[model samples]
Target chain A: MNKKIKQNIAFFVFRLFSLLIVGVLISILGFIAINGIQVIDWEFLTTAPKEGMTEGGIFPAIVGTFYLVVGSLIFAVPLGVMSAIYTVEYAGNGRIVRFIRMMTNNLASIPSIVFGLFGMALFVNKLGFGDSIIAGSLTLGLLTLPIIIRTSEEALKAVPESYRTGSYALGAGKLQTIRKVILPSAMPNILTGIILSVGRVSGETAPILFTVAAYFLPSLPDSIFSQAMALPYHLYVLATSGTDVEASRPIAYGTALVLIMIVLFFNLLAAFLRQRLNKKLKQH
Target chain B: MIETKNINFYYGDFHAIKNISMKMEPNTVTAFIGPSGCGKSTFLRLFNRMNDLINNTRLEGECLIKSKNIYDKSIDVDELRKDVGMVFQKPNPFPKSIFENVAYGLKVNGVKDKKFIAQKVEESLMAAALWDEVKDKLHKSAFELSGGQQQRLCIARALAVAPSVLLMDEPASALDPISTSKIEELIHQLKSNYTIVIVTHNMQQAARVSDKTGFFMMGELVEYSDTKKMFLNPDKETTQNYITGRFG
Candidate 1:
């Protein structure tokens, strides 16, 4: 065959491979929707599970997941954003800075199970928190810290240097410049990073499994020290370790569907925020 | 008045500005003319310490304004910057409304009175000769303005803080001839109030706007004299050649 024909065939193969990945994603989504859509209802969402983990809803799990996400973000976002600003804006390229950056990158690649073990040892046992919401939240926060810091640093770096120079030349101090100019410019990207971390924290089961996940909690958690039922762990228990795995299959699919929907909702919210904030920035 | 005494500058041991000395009178326009990489722009930035933002840059010799050394540790850099405003070659209006762009300097200085900020913004815009065109659209984004208008907006921004000195680093180099002439006209009008130092590659522009002219080449001051004499009867052979279009 000639070169042009060979190139066309190669391009066709690449396109097919790309479509295959999308096809797989759609197939999985379709399978879950078919199996899980029937079991979803308002009552199912607002009430606790009934009759030996086979009947009612995943309400406690939903509430527990919400609390966990909020708790993690409260612990992580400020610390992550501030650390990013320090690295990107204040810290010069010195040995310590390089070492910190290297450590963060390494942390990002560690397996989720390893993070769970670390969390179990540090927050759960050593801190005497036991299997509690705070332990789980802190663990998830640790799991997501590297991601948030890296993304936030990228966002901060994306702001043009001209803006900083302009602010400084106008006699604005470093803090004022960051608060008024740099933060505003980087807000949308930081929000994006937070949304991504929310997705990761919500879907993660291994980290919460060792740190805080309860086998079956039908009621709402009253305090940070209470063991919680997160969606991922709930789904995992319903599928694998339930008294009747065959009967609990629908509930398992329902939990998975709700988790996916929650993630999708947050992603949509992030997209909306990005659009609004970008418009505001441009309007100036 | 501004004076530099035997100033030598380096970028990490690469001597970028050789020993150069010059004096500038207050409320007069002094222009530096040089080819690219000749350190004319670098010299202009030294007035406001803009070069301090770059790393590994060092300066020797006193840069005094109004008989006070600005680079002294005792002097506040922010206060010094407020006293000395700078406009760059490119029109860098912040991504803010035209009104905010002009009012930025005053606001940063803790000026919270709304009426005062409004009045100062107007006065600065008027001084920059951009008030009439933008008066009706002050709330609009600064990016919406034409390049020339944006350049004038930046000038107005610099003027808002009421600085005694204004440094223009090839202010009109990026502009069209018509915009360039408008800027030149504004510079002429501004000289009655602020000390103006401009760097330009356009020799004609230097002659048109400046009262005194300094020629720089290869990071050294080649000639310094009154603009009329510098253009008419240059003392140095190199200055003569440069003016007569022999070489940069």
Candidate 2:
């Protein structure tokens, strides 16, 4: 075949694959929306389950998932951002830095089921927290920690080198330079890391399965130590293991749609915040 | 006011600056002119120790400013930098407002009196010949200014710390001819208050702005003398060929 014909065929294949993924995503969303939209009244959203997990809304699971997301972020963001600053800024490319980077990469690739088991062994049983929000959050936090660290490191590194040199030339110390110049410049990008972690922590079922998820809870969690009904785990039980699986299928679809919406909400919030920060940096 | 004694610098195993000794008088404009990669900019950075930021770089010999060894173990590098300020090849204004850009040096040095900072910012801007252009929009972003104006803002930022020595590493090389002339004129006016050292690829720029001139070639200072004598009657044949546009 001629080069032009070969190039045309390659381009067509690439376009087909890209559109294929988009088609798959749209079909899944359409399936869930069509099957779930009828069950999504205000009463369905705000009330507890009725008739043995067959009727009513998954309010407690919604709140529980929300709590887990917030808790995980509270646990991971500070630790991850600080670690990234230390590794990317203060730590030169020495043996220790390389070792730390290697360990982080290894941690990122570990299966979420392993994190679930580790959390059960450490937070749930050994530490005696038992299947509670705190334990589950810590587990999910660990799962997302490597992602945050990698992203924050990239964000810090993305800042122009001239800013650091400019600050130092003005006689600013390392800490001051980072706090005043580097951190402000890297804030928008670091927020992207936080956004990504929120999405990951919210949708995860395995890590929370053995740590914090409840099979059936009618009320919202009263404290951090209380067993919580998370959306993903609740959906899993309703769709797969529950006695009234066919009856609760619509509720499970609704729960999946709500989870996706929550993730989308947080992503939109973060994108808005990034825009404001960039504008603030530019205007004043 | 500035002196180096047999300075030798290396980037790993590759020697960048050979043994070179020179003295610059206080309150005079001294220009170092050379081709690219001739170590003129590297030698200029030695005054402020900007090269310390790079890794695996080695320096041998004493760099003294005001008769104090800046490279001594006891010296505080930040403190030394405050006494010697440098402007870079490209204008690097922080992503901040015009007022904040000039106030950065003072704020970093722990000056908290808002009134004093405001006054110093004004004075520094005036000294850099930028106050007339940007006085009305102090709160606007520094990026809003033109390239020439931003370079002057950087100079104003350096002057806010009250350094006695100013170093310019090809400050006008990236600018247009009109802006270059403006920077050259600013350097002439700034000589009485600060010891100025500049590195330029333009030999005519050195002749026009420098009181003393140093010609560097392949990591060596081939000649150092009064600007008129170096350009009019160079001591070395190479310097003569270079100044007369014969050397490649």
Candidate 3:
């Protein structure tokens, strides 16, 4: 019943929780940095793919991963941001709006593999997109859409009500406030959503295998109609498809490290943007 | 001039404002003074139809601007908002450059000429008494300003569009004494070019700045008279008791 005793207990619990989170992140970072850097090489990064089960490089896969992420961003940013705008700004608490909200929440929790399956059925087969870069990109786009939408919705929501009031008071229309005030304010968060989705897409294998097809193509796809290779699919091949995997062990760790690095780079970018925005926002 | 006649509003079957009617003169300042939940804000919001966003809310009466029924179905809500600007208790500047924040109104109303937008932004800032502090940093983000500066920026933003009526909801409530006085002086100067309706709980602020003051209590307009009469010679004993700090 002592007040000091209660306060001390609360402080201890807070420190304990903080330590738990920091401990986990530090452990993961250490493991990835230690295991991944040993196999990473400039040759591995620059060299094109080879036919030998042990001699091949992940260049095509890396390139394909880039295309997939860029493609998905192209597909998702406009639609995701627009949907968030509609939900936050335009549509009120109506049945149609509720339905859209319900669907978006449902979509967020569905596994990436399910999205991959959906992509296979819809784009690769039903829609006749085939096992091309476009199909894979579309599938990945679908996979990332929910994440982008949810995170972007949160970002848009976090913009203070005063900003909206200020814009509205200025005689700006609903769209004008959203476009000029709301969206710009929420942009750093939206960019984080895009970066996170890119990480998820680059590391996924099962989805790409079904839609992108695991062919050792000599050249990059010249058109959307052309099939492509990706880093995750190549890792899967070297690890499982009876390739020279004793040597491929380092390659897998190296590839994992590369994926982690790319994700970290984007994460760093998001942090930088958040810091800059916060410094400016604190003045007012 | 803005006027409301026999206005009644309900929120989900609960009466929020009942049979409220008043006329606000042009080129002067009016203050809405009342306890919380007395519908001063609701009444202020009605001028620009900001209550349209509220769910399951109903209205029955006429809100007129210059004798034209604003509630008439054909009236464009967007155009009306352009003429009647509002400011909230807290300062909220866009995460944009000072120039952009001031230019936002002109841009929204289809003014695309960059030269015109630049000139209007300057005039609005000058009108709000914030030009000197921010003139050199027009390109800096509006959010980089201090709290008082942000509030003034908001005023500039509203004045940029040349709105005839300015509805300020406790604009100085969030400011320190110095900032609050600056806003009061700005409001005093602004009344010459724009009709101003300010809502305040501070009796001193209402007495100091308002030409006419409306006292609201329990969703009713208890007193509406010249500020001098309302504060000095009281008609209703309830108004007298309130002014003397008997009850909020």
Fnat values, candidates in order: 0.59, 0.65, 0.63
Clashing pairs in 3: A61-A230, A61-A231
Winner of 1 and 2 under lDDT:
2
Per-residue lDDT over B1-248 for candidate 1, one digit per residue giving the tens place of the 0 to 100 score = 99999899999988989999999999999999977899999999899999998999999999999999988999888888888998988888887899999998998899999999999999999999999999999998898998899999999999999899999988888899899999999999999999999999999999999999999998999999999999999999999998888986
Q: After aligning candidate 1 to the native by TM-score, how far in Å is the CA of A213 from where it should be? A: 2.0
- For A161-253, candidate 3 gives per-residue lDDT tens digits of 878877777777888888887887787778778778877877777777788855577777788767887877776776766356686676766
* Strongest candidate by DockQ: 2
For model 3, what share of native contacts is present?
Answer: 0.63
lDDT of every predicted structure (CA atoms): 0.92, 0.93, 0.84
Q: Model 3, range B145-190, lDDT digits (tens) per residue?
A: 8888989999999998889999999998988999999999999999
Sorted by TM-score (best first), the order is 1, 2, 3
Candidate 2 on B193-222: residue-level lDDT in tens? 999999998989999999999999899999
Docking class of 3: acceptable
lDDT of 3: 0.84
Worst 10 residues of 1 chain A by lDDT: A275-284
TM-scores for chain A over all candidates: 0.97, 0.96, 0.84
Model 2 has an lDDT value of 0.93
DockQ sort, best first: 2, 1, 3
lDDT of 2 by residue, A139-198 (tens): 999999999999999999999998898888888889989998899989989999999999
- Flag regions of model 3 displaced more than 4 Å: A1-39, A247-250, A269-284
